[model samples]
Target: MDEVLIVVGPDVVADAGLIEEIAGREFAALGVRGSVTHARDAAHAAELLRDGAVVIPGRSGEMRELIGRAAGAVVWVDVERVDGVEPGEGATHLHGRGLGGIAWGIRHAAHRMRHPGRRRIPYGPHRDQWGDLYTPADSAPVVALIHGGYWRSIWAADLMEALCADLLARGLAVWNLEYRRPDLHGWEATTADVAAGLAALGDAGKVAVVGHSAGAQLAFQAAADGARVTLAVSLAGVLDLVEGDRRWLSSGAVAAALGRRVPRGAQASHGRSPHADDETVRLYIAASPLLRLPLGVRQLVVQGSADDLDLVDFGRRYTQAARQAGDEVTYLEMPGDHFDVITPATPIWQATAEAIAGALA
Candidate 1:
């Protein structure tokens, strides 16, 4: 009985087929069925409202009116617009545009960095719970680089080897941290591994924690949860897990990682959640740095304009929230993509080094 009614505007009717195809794949991935219906006018959209969940790509006069009237409807916006519906209107937003080609370019560049000497140290019994120590000549300032792949098993700390080498070249010791992923291990297990890994670093005084994507969440949590970290660098971090889930970033990777146990359903499809009793919800809230503010340390959020939309918003909102909560925070928005912060060849990486240097000072 559940169906998705995608309403396309008159201007974009020509490309309705392509849009529908993409929408279908996305919906099917989430185990939901969606049907595309091009509406000639606002009246036609209203007539199709009762069909099922309605999807309106971007802002439209008709869609806006429908949003005001049908509060119970599961509305989705393909791309967020300035005149979009209010947050309280119960709608889900999607980040349809991305720089996949640019990201690939940066990934190849990241893979080309000169290999540096690294000492592997075990943090826990599991092979995934280990740290790669890239040391300078003397007892230099330490920077912990945490890699991100939406807390999934596919991404590991190996991808950050080049970045670690770059930091070592800059006369800073780098700790490329690896922890269990939520997909492979349970969320609690993964979070516990991150905490344990930080604890295993021993008395590494006042080190800076640099996290990218999913790692950003862990980095923030490590700092707030009593890691020996002085400064926290969130490089295009997914700081807001709740918002990340609603926006369906990384093709519902957040939802996939969270699994179906929590049953986010339509409640979480909007920005906030109604179910606080769910174990997954509890764990997410406990781990979310955005919800638990005032980390009590200097923080730098490095964001890229050309990065994934979810990451961009996460950086902006997290920086503002930290500052508002009386924590010293700096936000650096540069012209780059998601992987630029980790690619040594990019200017974003240089900026990140500068931020770490300042944090060390």
Candidate 2:
């Protein structure tokens, strides 16, 4: 039987016992052996990296060195912050998820062991420009999933893992994408990466782009800009950048994402406010899905009734605009939160999956 190791950093304040308990449960369920150890320091952590799958909890620059040495998969769990140290290649990272992140990492490691066909395919040279590809034995329609953390680097392709698994189970190819974020990279790079990611799936049949939150905007922009997308699905997406910026959604996440710099004494005007700079306005117009109507592709806009009111508003308005612009759109607004649309077990996602299947048909 395969054995997995859970290494807890000495400085980490989380409950190691609880993590072990969780890891044990997960390993047993996956038919893998598991053990937990507390590392005294960086050297100790490195020493423990010689064997089966490894799950390291806590952020440590030293752990990055051990990534190449691990014989099996490496999963890093950062319980504290989103901007924690990156483990680079040969490692999967789960950040800002607290203790649960450890469990998730373990599960991910186990999944990698169980499913050898799952592959990480790179679309660009940069470390972030890649997608996790999951496919069935037969050829199927591709579903490219774009995750969202308001265009921040913290959230990544891992956000869509559950949905990827769900879609693959339903006999669809899954591409959980990761791209450069505007916060670390420039907004242009972010857009370019999205386009490139979609283009990488050229040979994959009947591509459907499903993006959540900020990713929804990217997905829509890709479709509008003439990516090879047959259907575009937006889940609680920030479709309208101008209004999202004006509303100061997520404490001004939209402006920050667009790299907006509002000059002093600049006044709000015509859906372009707070930052009326010409370049900023141009960016908003180009990036926003609401502004880019008649995307010329079938669209499925799913909004949660209990999500951020701004998002709900954007979804509804965008659907209306798309329909008026002569675009085929299917709008689904139901009782759910921002995340329910992505959770495979939820009714909203069931409805969404059905809609996507029908559209792809």
Candidate 3:
């Protein structure tokens, strides 16, 4: 008989039910009948995994110790912490490329990235801009990418071409997305472009999405499309709307794009914003994969340690919710910032490709 072990963090009151359910039900759903142990003590978990494969929702220091002792006992899922990189609130200066220039480069690179998605199939005169044929043909599996500028428009898609190329080599189609700035298009309109781009792709085979920073918010829509999406990868994904609402207000620059036209008299900053209309707030939460993750789709959240803008707990909360929602979730915690995962040549992309291929298979 095969076996699996699931370890949940000791939030005791909150995670108790989750631990029990995962230990019992999750593996059962995967068609494996085995003992599910929800152990608070990592030492005990290590002892148990010697019996069979293990599944852990979190890799705590204590759990790490136990796993290190008997790492072979577990088939641990990689969980990401929040990106520790503190992206500038506004346009930041680069040694050679200033903020606007960087933005311009991103827009241009997004334009040049268009190519055949696969070798055998012909990608069309697609409506979307960030089109690079991954398979040497067109429109195989559009990994439509959207960069995060905090809706600030400074961080464009220029820094991400490497990630796109890597996905293409892995035989996954790439769509490196660029959108109208908060200065020009506003958040709603920018997202509309995302919708349009996806629609333009015309329901290709299992569109798997990868979004970084603000794009992580957009990836939620791709995963939640409830379409034939295979998997959704969020690297330093911005999954919480409340956090975004506050950041938008504080940065002030995002008001141009994020539909954050501050109300004249509203003074509330915590819980929920007083100025945000029901629809707007709903939209923000809607874009959040954490709130909208579907049951069938697999989700991989890759976050960095000690990330500055997005908190680590935010990623933890997201994975926890997905587990509760009955979605297959894999989390990876690498040691890097928001840009680390997107560094095309980085091992992060390779790991991501492996995960994607596994999911697609």
Candidate 4:
């Protein structure tokens, strides 16, 4: 029987259904039967590779190991950039570098069900960095938590803790903060909540804000707006604003929030950005970290090649701009997708924990 075998690493639940469907269709199109099986690890894949099996594109240590181990025996495929997809496809149907696409759906739902919307929480500050204090003045550093979404009415501050739950073990307090969205108020309302929370904390140096996705951009904007931040981080922030603002303006939520259609054109869109409190023509340049620096804060930005949103090339482009402006910025790129840096039990999480620890220490 003419057939093709599909090999995949056991760790990739996100790609399972797509891989199977693709294999079956390809098999039929080629007049052959296609079967998919999990390799358990690279060792089994090594055997398949030895038999001239074609390697499916996915990135895991085992997949990479098998490819390097059998470069000649197998044909490597970038199944992600699948041969054909039509123009004007919705963003959800496409694949992003790391976990951008999958993470988006999972996160969008998670954020909506979890975060809700803008609300204020009490907090406190420590020594060194200048921020408000909520808890009694002591040596304990505040743990700043951030959430991710497209930054619209569809999501709020939910699920920020799951991927970043471990900062507590390192002697820091965590802050699960929120920002404005299409359903909420404007950017001013969101940042104002942040500003109020930080002020409540008391010591800016004792606080660290760890933010994800759209939350990252909000964090930087918050720090820049005189919030007295000690340390800040952005996890797959749509900081560049080029793509994000476009996407936001495209969404129905933006109109609902603004009470009008999102005016197109770069100048018009920038003017209507949720980053502001009102539809004022001013502060467009001052608001974006990419356009201007939110000075006096130490920052870290981590991205991955597999996740398109955090790709070093763009997405979070504001970090570099912030760095050039002489703000202390550290950039980290790793394997996996957008949420990869924040996912459970990885060096990314460990390193992030340590950075926050040191910043407060």
**What TM-score would each prediction reach against the true structure?**
0.65, 0.85, 0.57, 0.54
Per-residue lDDT of model 3, residues 75-166, tens digit only: 33223321122212211111122212322322222223233122212232322233333443544656766777665544555455667666
Ranking by lDDT: 2, 1, 3, 4
lDDT agreement with native, every candidate: 0.69, 0.81, 0.55, 0.53
List of clashing residue pairs for candidate 2: none
| TM-score, model 4 to reference | 0.54
Candidate 2 residue-wise lDDT, 123-142, digit = tens:
99988999989989988999
Q: Point out where model 3 deviates above 4 Å.
A: 1-130, 137-140, 225-227, 247-256, 261-280, 293-296
The predicted structure with the larger lDDT, 1 or 4, is: 1
User: Which scores higher on lDDT, 3 or 4?
Assistant: 3
Q: Weakest 10 consecutive residues, lDDT, candidate 1?
A: 99-108
Q: What is the lDDT of residue 194 in candidate 1?
A: 80
Best by TM-score: 2
lDDT per residue, candidate 1, 1-361, as tens digits? 3555566655442355566556666455434555667777777766665423444533466555665564443444434223223422333232222222112212222222223246778888876788878888889878888888888664557567668778888888888888877776877787788888877778887689889988988899888887878898898898887777777878877777766433455243222567666677765666778876888988899988999877887888888888988999989999999878887878988987877887786
